[model samples]
Target: MTITATRSTELDQHRELNADETAVKSVRARIAEAGVEYVYYQIVTLTGRVVGKVVPARHLPRNIEHGIQAHPGVVADLQVDGSGAMLAGSPERGECVVLPDLDSFGVLPWDTRTGFFFCRMYEPDHAPGDDGGRPVPIDARGNLRRVHAGFTARTGLEMRSGIEPEVTWEVPGLSTEHVPGTPHTMYHLEHMERLRPVYQKVIEYGRALGLDMIEGNCEDPGQLELNWMFDHADRTADRLILHRQICRRVAREAGATVSFMPKPADDRFGNGCHHNISLWDGERNVFVDPDVPGLHLTQTGKDALGGILTHAAASTAVMGPTVNSYKRYLHTGQFAPLEINWGMDNKTCAVRMPANGRLEIKSPDSMVNPYLSHAVLLAAVEDGLTQGIDPGLPRTTGTGVPSPFGSLPLTLKDALDLFAVDQAVARGLGSELADLFLRLKTREWERFCASVTDWERRMYGAEGC
Candidate 1:
């Protein structure tokens, strides 16, 4: 069934269940064949964390017909403000329904008896007026799908992306200590070999769950980056979420702890989730300029880049959500982009054209919410295409050099301020999501401001004594 803005989600649910009997039967057959006993109906939250309910495989048909219900505040991670009030909504707001996407069904490789499905959220049927069973506006995953569909319908172009997620692992025999004169372990073969068992299991599970594992390596002392082939923006986002889950399971089995934190230490290199993006028109890459020389972009690519640069600051609040996320930007010579500019093969620029036909956005950290990030990017690109925005020449100077376009937002507060004013970003996230996101992040910023840190205590404790 086609989902449109005008169509009620209740009607869509009814049509999908009534017409997709064959698909349901197929899933049942697969479940029996795989001996699956339990199923997880997973939902992605506003912060990209996974939250949901699990049901027995025997209840698949019943659950699909009537989705599982949970408090809508899960979208905000059930967070509370300084006054101890629920951030998402009041308790009387009732629960939301989570319906699984049939196409996302897959058996867990770690436990063959268990399977999972990514779900879309909807308001409960007993809601006031016609709001019943309506799509949840604050649902990040659902919002991305809707936004992408609208973008494709309007522009006849598709955005494909691959994310390079860097994670730090705390494992046995892996030391963060660096000898004074010895070479560091970044990309070293010995370090990669030490983490072979960990990466091997991760890749195996990833492949079983439909990730086309391509390559991986050990960067820094305990950091690793394993990548898969890029696909449609929505699929990429789903895979990223799955990848994190797989990493967690692997870490549990290996007696290690994995961290997706952007900056784990003051002296260490920050973890970045750089997005390699391209615009496609059917089989052709619209960003490519085959007639031009090396590392050239088409006019379409330039405009898209302009939009990204134009909205880079506003998007950073989603890309780097945590308080520690801004710490990644404080260090120089760390590959993190400090300036809001594009460059050809320059790793220090916020947006870099590493090769033709794609741009790599360096602003996103390991903790980014891909759903929100991609949605904002789509809006920025759409505005660029519509307005014919032009990104100026690429930067060729060294790191710390200022660009004509100014620097990236240094703090979450700064980014939030920009996000508050940027209509394109607000429109991208939709009004409801934008408002919810702003509220959550603003509370986070305020909490951080109210707390005292070790640095502050160390400096101020002895001052004027």
Candidate 2:
């Protein structure tokens, strides 16, 4: 459906809101049945931040039929790419419509009167003569959908994945100072019990938000690792986004701050969102190759691992998207990987075959955008499978052996450089996305480099020669 912009002075006058009849009916039913008074129409920005406009539940009809209007360039608010410039030039562009995914309508467990819906951006005029009016090109979730479709079409297989999201939280009065949970004592039940009320609420809200909420353990001071049932790759990615939102909301209500920053502190253990993956064909677990000795992952598994390893450096730009993410990779013994290698039940390697059929990529951190990360890995795996690439030996030569695929990227800059030059990643993520991402990250790197930190000021202040 098309809606002419009421406020034309700000941007364009036309808007396109695309939704089908069935979706509209479903959304309407949910709003009434759930007694939801307000609905947040949300989208994920390039920085993985959730930003959007909220509409009254009374306007569910309008929003479902003709998506709510939002600033066209909001998704790229921080996306400074190619020309070493931010998206400021196109700031005044007209509003774009965000079509709500009816399937995503869920009542915020913490607040029953409010509901939330994830949306996809589309240009106003999808006319034949219109040049720029199309599906928002930078939509990571949309891009992942496209990539997943192509992979399924080509290989007749689907990927299943589970995410172990480790996040840290701090309470208002009790946990004033940021510190690791009792120094190096991992998974202590006492820590979990100490914060039982806070985490219990998290689990409660998580289930209400449609998450499976398998279990959670205290990883460090104020840090907890939560698990949910795994599902199809795309679905799992969606769940991760919801999972993060739930954690934050729950923490806020408890008068605490929750963070998914990969490395919130330099000395403590960084939060890692490790990806556990497997491939399937129909009802069969193709990844489980009983004929293969030892690890038992099939040839298909090897190829996928090979593709991932081949693009390990470039994928780091997505897996570990933030500047602080690099801090997690500082050492080998810290559970974060320093080298690009796959091993059997080895946490030190980039990819670890923790179970018989499931493989885990330890490179990604809590900072990753789940949609983009899953898309990148799927594309890399496809590249490997299609070309029949081998992932080399399983690094069975032991923990101290030299890295076969060399060292993983240590910083956002290094990852961006490798990502920019990698044709495979370019093809995987599409040139447009890869270029835009590089631009945004380059700007981040520039900002970081330009900033003078407290440590820098302290150390170099006295050395003014």
Full-model lDDT, candidate 2: 0.79
- Runs of candidate 2 with Cα error greater than 4 angstroms are 1-24, 78-85, 126-133, 172-183, 290-294, 397-400, 463-465
Relative to the true structure, candidate 1 reaches a TM of: 0.95
Where model 1 places Cα greater than 4 Å from the true spot, the runs are: 1-19, 398-401, 462-465
Model 2 TM-score, 2 decimals:
0.89
Name the top TM-score candidate: 1
Candidate 1 residue 166 Cα shift, in angstroms, is: 0.2
Estimate the TM-score of every prediction.
0.95, 0.89
lDDT scores for all predictions? 0.89, 0.79
Model 2: per-residue Cα lDDT at residue 232: 91
> What count of clashes does model 2 give?
6
